[model samples]
Target: MDVKQVSVADKARRWIFSVHFCTPIIIIISPRLQILILAFLAASVSACKMNRCYNESELSEAVERKLRSHYHQPPDPLPAADPDSPSSCPVELYQYLAPHEENRRSLSPWRYVLRSMKDHFPSTYSEAECLCSGCILIQDVPGKGRVPVENFSYTSVPIIQSRVFLRRDLCGDGGKYRLTPVSQDVAVGCTCARPMST
Candidate 1:
């Protein structure tokens, strides 16, 4: 063969060998790249799962603490009811009070107080036979007769006590109750005592 022809043929052979040799290396590396990508994806998924699990546990713990606190029995010797006071709301009621705009959709103060009393002090509540009276006004209504004030305050009285026995039992030492706001972000109160005023 001519020298030029021979040189051209040698060049083609080298090119073919280079391609043949490099092809397998590329092919081999592809699977390793895929494996690395898959490993990264799996790790990300596991991390997300772990985060969700942690959040759920935290939520459960918060709920459990709240339930325990709500149901726990109060310390002995309920506060004495002031005879002269026209309003006698449970201290717990203060916890329910917040900015009016935030609490517009919430349960009425009267309802919350009744529910708390029933749940926490069932025996005393049942025995006391408390009847939930509606809002009491300072003056008498034309047809509704004079509204007798049970609890009086500068703000609205959220609770009332009746002269007639609604429940015949005493509440015992479990009567002292306080309202605790759940979220610092939101203005809220429980049906217990007024913390701010006190």
Candidate 2:
């Protein structure tokens, strides 16, 4: 087996010379052209370095930076509801400190574990969930008999869709990991309203 080593300067030169400016003809290139080529090479090398995402260590550093930023800043306050239209069933919400905190426990028997699994990429995923999922007002209504229930209202929880950043591997792009948005459902709040049958 043969392994070839590539230096940064050699790679930069290869990238710069691969441009259309290089030709087989032995013509004297102008000083301006030489300057342009050098500038292009520097720009390409810098951009490549900036865009490189090689390993999990980089991901860890990025996630830590984002978490620091998230913790340092205060979260936005929830909007106040109008006094006239106050809801009887209020929803209590809490934020998760880690990614997929809701699904950390495995309930199924056929759970497959990956030895190399790591933390999720950082995202603007500060959405909350409802603490209660049962209807308070509907508890008085009898389940067996069709009692004439007056002023009976059902509390419905409102669900919202939020995007979270997940790591993805690009097969053709040297197996680099990139962050992509994945849709997740979040329960924002609950509202009390009259049922359709009422």
lDDT of each: 0.32, 0.39
lDDT of 2 by residue, 27-101 (tens): 334447779989999999977654456465676675455445532333422442332342322211112123443
Error of 2 at 13 (Å): 39
State the displacement of the C-alpha of residue 90, model 1, in Å, after optimal TM-score superposition: 8.8
Model 1, span 1-198: residue lDDT tens? 111112343343211121245343212223456678799999999665433321323544533454465444232223323333344333334434465522221222332111123322122321121122222224565886654332333233233322111111222344322322221111122222322475
On TM-score, the candidate that comes out on top is 2
Candidate 2 clashing pairs, residues 3+ apart or interchain? none
TM-score of 2: 0.33
Clashes of 2: 0
Which 10 residues in a row give candidate 2 its minimum summed lDDT? 104-113
What TM-score quantifies how close candidate 1 is to the native fold? 0.16
